[model samples]
Target: MTDAPDQIPEPEEGAAADSAEHPESLGDDGEFGGVEEFDADARDAADAVYAALLERVGEGAPRPRLEPTRRAVELLGDPHRSAPVIHLTGTNGKTSTSRMIESLLRASGLRTGLLTSPHLERFTERIRIDGESVRDEVLARNWEEIEPFIAIVDAELEGAGESPLTFFETFTVLAFACFADAPVDVMVLEVGMGGEWDSTNVADGQVAVITPIDLDHQSRLGNDVVEIARTKSGIIKPSASVVSARQQDDVLKVLENAADLTESTLAVEDDAFAVISTTVAVGGQLVSIRGLAGSYHDIALPLFGSHQAQNAAVAVAAVEAFIGSGSVRLADEVVETGLGAVTSPGRLQIVGSGPTVIVDAAHNPHGAGSLVASLGEAFDFDEVVIVLGVLADKDATGIVDVLAGLDARFIVTNPGSDRAADTDRVAGIVATRVGADRVTVIERLDDALDEARDWATEGEKRAVVVTGSVVLVGDAIAIAADRGWNAR
Candidate 1:
């Protein structure tokens, strides 16, 4: 990896001379910060910045190389080192776990920065500071200052006959810069993909959190669970405190080896930390978690599912690992408050009432099983209609098998992603498992939702669930919001 930049670069020769001649161009900060005379100008500038980022590389395909991100951040004075980092990685529950960790740290009276991936609605949702999405002005301003350094690296890579940085690599640099500019005390970074080569891995975390590694990204990670676990275990740094969720035997062996090599303190779920009990409640669930420090009882997690209960357990342990290196226990009130206020947007998130509509980002069999279990535990629906859209590379058959036992009808559709499996393909899979008569094919998600809503309204205790891909969950969320469905 390239060494961190010694200092922010000086202006170009012409700009320096122009600044000397015209004092107003320099501004007080000397970095393009002046009073915006109108809101429209700021909005237009933000739009331009977002467009420029999208133009460089699309999010769907990312080249897994850290050299470009390393070079880019090196030229920006290595802002990633400004705060202590809590790095998180796993096949499932990474985003939800990251959100929980951020909430816990923020409740501890620290200014926190959070960077997570696959935003449900806006790109701004990826970078959050102090529990809120970063403002458009802040994103635009950071892009203005960081663009020149990125351009330098882009030219160098192209000159060497290599492609420019991918979308996620560049965004990683932006997140680091924004967090450093905010001057946060702690930063919680969730990996965009695998851990070792992910751009966000440039920062050595003080604590590493792994949440239930599974067989989701087999195409990119590996075909087997063991190999995927090995790839994810790379986030655990030497002497770092590691908090991991309960893993299978083969996966656990891989993580143990990684911890041994790194000389890290590893805390496995059901050993060092675990969820004692979870009782379904109104709005969400009440979970009692045995943390690394102490036991937190009856903590209100404003999200559904047993997987979420486990996620809460891991988040508490990660926070405990961060706060006192797993030596000191957090105050009960602090832990209670932090978890009570947590909200995971699309993970078993109910967006509407009256034939309740739920959306979850469960793209694989493991996650799909969790969704089915959670639905059984949390909701008492006599019948259900599921709007399912899966990516082309996913295990459509495995996912359908997991949910086939549920008393539900399937509506297969497109998730607005180029990689989405064809509606007919998914419908065939659903039909093979649950019978052809129980399956419906609606190519568009909006139309699928309309049909599901009609089905849900026909029965006494019926509901609708949208799942299979993050892209579909994002689209469903936007559609629900547009139709005035309040997210709970």
Candidate 2:
């Protein structure tokens, strides 16, 4: 990693010339044309593909191994190696950071492929081609072609007294194949979980971006921050340039050790680069970032929160490292256009109006903390109605503890997943923290949202926040669209 200078420097003449020429358009249609619609036949085919994937082991039960994915991809000609990868792994900001990286890359004239986890609405959302979700026809066709190779791997694993390729493992393979088929110039990959043995680790990332290591997925990743950091640091491959967000001292030590062992250079937030300042703006916030190669002033980021601003800084550095080895400054316009067009769905996203409805996927305590801070910074409300749901494996008590600080009423509900924590249990946790007078138990999500929206309508400066699980946020987004909450 390059050392930061005492003062920011202006770009030398022709510095922007080396940057890739801006494309006529970023996608086949246009920027933000939206996901393509599926015909009945295409929908059925896509549904069949999803059903087949569901038949395998679920994402919750990930096999902490890479050989199976390696074997499958190897048989498919190692599609993961087809493009230079910018890989990201972290607790809270992985998805958002990945989106920022992909957007910046795309704006710089690269045909980008992105893979993110646990989709909010559709399976195709996990794999994006040039800033849009992969089309259903393309997804179905790719699945049809890869099914044979997947079956071969499954039989091989089963023959060796092991389970079949798990959902994430196979999904990782499929995503790689899709990107390779698209022949993307670059791929931004987000790990499904901890990095070391996560199936996505098969690809050597040219730039490994770590976004703020924190405590989450304790049972699977580790029992503490150090253990989790050690697991995530596994993505720092040989001679890779690593860019990381601000982290705890202990976690930084773990990443530093891994980088040293791999002979990789590590650049951390506040050391290599930083968010100089941020001011809340109309739709989002205006940020000034001091990047590894250059300084960007007042870039408009459409996402909310200081965490997102931090994520943007890390992304800028990652792109700097990938494109110019942290030496050449990105074109000022590139930074402006890229950051300006970025969007992170379900992270502080407002899906409705009148009685404003916001949905965030802050399922863990660290994420919950960021959510509360962003809410305080971005929105003003006399009262907040929190429609909360939690997954069974999450730390409900810890999440509720963080949320209890808000001057808000809690409506505990299920997120419509089998993994949803019991409403009574979560409500009990909320009541203990905020008193019974502030708690409401709604067994169904739709009814819960309706009830919350009605209450918000009765008061001024009141909003409904649906959070706790990503699934719940997705459900809320759909419900908001269905009921025309934004129209009202």
Candidate 3:
């Protein structure tokens, strides 16, 4: 995360294999781990910087509020100017897609940087340079260094009487400082929310990546696909190229039109680049991509679900277009390594062997459909025990119906969050659709998970799939870590 801001080479299996293949590069002067060495405990600076950032957030231009972003950048001498980046935006698959790109780039023998969001475990997960998370010590040092200037910005903003910067906004500035200081070769950025006003949009990316556009944050982005796509497409720069995954024609047209208006090159799946072949494999998915400008053969991505195949196509297309822009040339080995090395938690992530455990962030109908489709092709479970929690904004019934076909027993729980969906409300939906006897509403997530585990019948291995809200799955991941549930 921007908080740690240390250079790190992603600890990818492919990269490790590459080193083993060429042992000569494993020396002291050879390709180093992205992050050298640092303490992870020192978030004091991030806390301090965040405190200072909170003060000047609301005032007008030139004030410390939102404008301190620019002031801080200026203070840092505009470090982002030095690094070329590929920024990812969309409703779903941003984090997975970005990580895939980072691994791919690292396989090419070039240093890589990964900047994602909504970290499941730690804040440092957001800003990773080379391969390791930025050290917390570095973050604290920057906060201390920036304090006096932050105070100046706060004073100026207070004089102007403007609203303060939001939490996400201040974090955006801190991320830039972390990345700039790391001096990464290239950065993979995933947007926080709507692309237009999102902090990541401030950077002029070398390429803009748009994943499957859908409706999620209707309160901010919009109520429909077109309006939502419009906001997410804001990350596209005038001089940069744009890469998009498969989309409904109307939504695709909006992005295509935007690219045309900006005089930027546009490539869409099935139009420029596409997934030529896909199949469920012994381990994961076997995929093929036809890049608009080139073609990639069978790329083995060990991530289950059909959605992952699509995400892989987009990542490949992005790297192709990014390199085709006459800047970087991604080697075939690099592309293969990247696709094979990616891992996104709770997105059909399977944990344990006895009675398998799979977790996904399928908070809406669209994502739920993909999860179901992926599970249908990948496993043979006689009974599906679903540990789910949804947010207030999600379509709980719609999502429930999407996975209703399976031999499912619903265990609903609410992680302690203001926006978490009520377990009783969700149980009602399950009761009406499936049956009252099959539904159990449990308030505590840990209790619900235990209930799901208990539902496993002997001789017929029952798997637990934790889904619904990110907050729910995030908590599940945390619990899994605490109890050693992840190792299985």
Candidate 4:
């Protein structure tokens, strides 16, 4: 492990394990004793840390540079330098690709740490050590140890009239600290947004993975596809192995230029590796992929979409780059088991039955297009009802346009997020794209979902798709589970 500067000490001594004001701690009365008390303590501690981090700037706001994160980690002894990193960034597919890569590495007998962003449910979903979300106690304890150091940095930045570290930056710091404490063999990191100054970029990745780049986050990243690709290309470190998905001509040029400048070896989809075919199966789909070193055939990836197949191909190449320099074939069993074990929580995930409720976190047009295509290819629904909710800053028109041509009814609602676009505004957009008669306006996601289920249950071969934002998908999952609906 890389040493912290001046031997960073442990958490402040004598800090309360369970504070009185904590909601969970309050339940620690006789009503909740023994294991329940222990569990409450864990939850309380984790929430305490989360509440503190949420006080900073929001995750959507990108910091201009990595200085704050760099300094925070530096003061804490640079925990990120402890493990080699596989850094991933792009408009979409980053989380799924990162998860696949982590599974593959773990199957090969390496303890893996995976750090992803915009988690669907719990904040702990953002950091996983050895394939499981870090325990609440561990996450809170790590934060407790680092809180003082973070405050010191915050004071320094405030003295200089600079903003304190944002939510994502602090989470990045905590992830590094947690991963180092776990002493993982390798870590897979997904950038929050554009790559150049992303807090996760503070660590030089040994294998930089770029999934299909698209025009999303145009306000923060540039409008042009090539320009967005250029910003994402920042993760390619000198001599690092670069694995990229198939890209547009201009995007390819930008990536090629970055690889050349960094003297990195580049492997691109359709050229070096690609998903040749995918056939829908019982649970998911069977795919055949041509990887960099060898061809993987008859691989069953339990995820929807040809895009996921593509993501699997990219993940294999990245793992090859990290473990074998893209020259050696992973064992067939290892490849099969690893790919099969992968689970992308909210990407075309089926969270309930009866109505066959499916949820996907497709916030942008490109992702929406992919989701629509996958739905067409994967399911045999006679009629589909879509529960749509989008963030205020998203391309709502583009999303509506993509789904307009589908044989589906639209239920526009909010995802229960402050950033969620108003239901009336979303309905107006949907109405413009696909006549208002086809669009149903609902204020709450749960009510919208109920309406969708009623519509689905009314006929044979009907289904429901909850989408447009990760928050909506999370809500759908919670609602389904609470209602005792079996996630098919």
Candidate 5:
């Protein structure tokens, strides 16, 4: 990995220089210059940035290589190296765990930059600084400064008869550049895909966190848990501290091997740390965590699910490893304040009341199972109407089978992505698993959610749950806000 430069390089001649000199045009202090009129202009510029990124290969089609991103960052003065990174990778819980780690670091009086994938709402949500989304002007300005360098790399790749940078590759460069421009004290990065060659892996992580490795993404990573585990273990850098959730024995063996090869110290859940107890509470739960250095008691985590409790344990261990190298115990107040303020949007998030609409981005069987378990433990609904949608590439059958165990009525719909699975196809799978009487198909997401919520409102102790895909959960959240579902 490249070492961080002693200082951020001055803007080079040409586009970079032009961008640097136009700070007022972008905004003052990365705000819209306090001019109500400039808000539209700032938003337009940010939209243009997303449009330009969408022109490349989409994130679903990730290129399993890093040199392209490495070269781009190298040209941009290696922005990714400007701060220490706590990198996380796995099938699920990566985003949630990354947020917790970032919060803990920020609470400890460090400015932090965070990068997570496939944002539920705006693309800007993927990159956060000090617990908030990076401002529109900042995102646009960084893209403008780096666009010229990206073009240079695109031309070079074409001349060599190779594909240009993919969407994730270019975005990885942008996120790193933004964080370095902010000059954050630390970074918590979530890998976009399998870790070995994911664009984010271009930066070496001081702490490598592996959430539970599972069988999702079989087409790209591997067809089994062990193969996927090996691919996910790629983030374990030489002599780095590795923290992982409890895994299948075979998966643990894979992580152990990776840590041994890298000469990194490996800590596993239930071994180095664990969730000792969890009590369901208002808005979320309280848990005791056996951390690497010490035990944390009755920590308030405002997220549901035992899986989330496990994720909290992993996050605590990760922060312990990063801040004190697993030697210094964090203050109890830091742990309480950090975790208390943590939020995992679209992961068992409550968007509405009355009929009680909820949204969870659980697209795979493992995530679906977690949703089922969390639902069972966290809510006492006599009836449930689940608004389900999934992407074409996901395991619709397995997901349906798992959710069927919840014994809830299902409304299948498209998640409004180009890759969304057909409503009829997913409905057929759901019907086969849970019987036709329990299944309904609604092509439009808004209509599906309306039907589910209306049905839920008819009975006492009934609720609506929107799950199956992140895009659908995002759509539901927006719809809930627009229709004032949460107000009811």
Candidate 6:
């Protein structure tokens, strides 16, 4: 583990773990105890107050709304200025890439702060200070402390005839402020969606990274690959260096143009830095990558899938570029240790044994393609049963087309959220591609996963995947954890 600077000690020292409502001293009499033990009416009021503010994703405000966040910082005295950041945006691999970057930086002995979204189970997974969840008491206190600023942002926005900030936007602002207060050495900020309008882009980053570009978020970004890539390319700022994957000619042109527009230096994969020959194994991958700094061979990643290798190459390049050619070079052992320590939840996460339940938040065509490939090469299941869900916003036909050719019988379900693809609607799409006889649409995620598990018997090797949206994967993980599902 990296050593924390004297300015920012390890979280265990009571610096990062200490929060208002979640201090280490409180036993169990907090807000989440028994409803009868606390003020139910007060809690209900607070929930309602924030519920409306959380309604902004995939609904309204496709363009960047940095003003509200800016107002928030001003009210709080510009906390964002305190944190250094590596902002990441793309169609896929943002979370995995973020984890890799965070871990690599941490390996250099810097106190790392990672903030991600659509957590598998607990909300705390979204914010980690010094490699741990924010102590519950601390988060609760910060929540209360930040509430006034949020409410003020809401009022001013509403008075200006604009909708309130969405859940993700609020989260972006909160994370920036919280990390600034914790004063982490650097933050790995993953764009919640497309980069141009993503709330996380509000922060000024010293480095910008773009992973593989594909067709996703067409409604807000655009229909063409270049348009979408342009949206993601928005994260590139003046004076920042770019580390990106190999992209289509058109998409590559767009990325370069954006880099030029921002006056940021661009490092093209396969040209300046590249990942060479690769081999995938059960626990990790072995690949040789050559970058502007140097070449690394057979570096292993603790995560699954080939896409992760690409993400790792991008991480390795970013670290090298950010630190320049001298003092902060990434030692080969740091690369090994960094990749070994990195893990992203719900991205081919093997959550249990007995029947082998895996969770992946592969809601789009590109992601679905990667998940299908990973299953084929990594596991040897005689039968693969997929428990799937999706958002209404996704192109259901496109998603199904990619997974249909894979060896899996899908038990489809509606994601347990308003954004979920309608169960009947999703089933209709699946039936067209994979046959209705093989597709079953159940409204509940738990029921779908349970049915997939039961069919895994009969003296046959079977693997079950709970996938599609993070909401569905999250629900499946919650059930597995409650029942003590084992991943080994």
Off by over 4 Å in 5: 1-38
Q: Which ten residues in a row have the lowest lDDT in candidate 2?
A: 16-25
Each model's lDDT = 0.84, 0.87, 0.72, 0.85, 0.87, 0.74
Name model 1 segments beyond 4 Å from true.
Answer: 1-40, 486-488
Residue 124 in model 4: shift from native, Å?
0.5
Clashes of 6: 11
Residue 96 accuracy (lDDT) in model 4: 91
Error of 5 at 429 (Å): 0.9
Q: Of 4 and 6, which scores higher on lDDT? A: 4
lDDT of 2 by residue, 1-488 (tens): 11221222223332222111111113346343432343678767877899999998999989899999999999999999999999999898999899888888988999999999988877778888877777666778999899999999989989999999999999999999989998799999999999999999999999999998888889999999999999999999999999999999999999999999999999999999999988877667778999999899978777778899999999999999999999999998888777777767789989899989999999999999999998888777889999999999999999999999897899999889999899999999999999999999999999998899999999999999999999999888778877887622
**Local accuracy of candidate 5 as per-residue lDDT tens digits, 346-458:** 89988899889889999899999899999888888888989999999999999999999988899998899999999999999988888899998989999898898889888
Model 2 has how many clashing residue pairs? 0
TM-score of model 6 (CA atoms): 0.86
What's the lDDT of the predicted structure labeled candidate 1?
A: 0.84
A best-first ranking of the candidates according to their lDDT comes to 2, 5, 4, 1, 6, 3
Q: Kindly list the per-residue Cα lDDT of model 3 for residues 1-488, writing each as its tens digit.
A: 01122222343543433221121222234234432333334455555554655455321122212255566566667765668889999878888888778877776655776778775555666766665555556566755665565556556656788444455656666677667676678888898887876767778888999999887777777889999999888888887889888888989999988898888988878877778877666557667777655666767777787788788888877887776662344566777777866667668877655667788988888899889988877777878889888888788988999878775988888956677777888899988888999889889989888878777745486789999887778778777767776443
Q: Estimate each model's TM-score.
A: 0.91, 0.93, 0.86, 0.92, 0.93, 0.86
lDDT-better candidate, 1 vs 4: 4
Candidate 2 Cα outliers beyond 4 Å, as residue runs: 1-38
Assess the local accuracy of residue 34 in candidate 4 as a C-alpha lDDT between 0 and 100.
Answer: 21
Q: What lDDT score is found at residue 429 in candidate 1?
A: 87
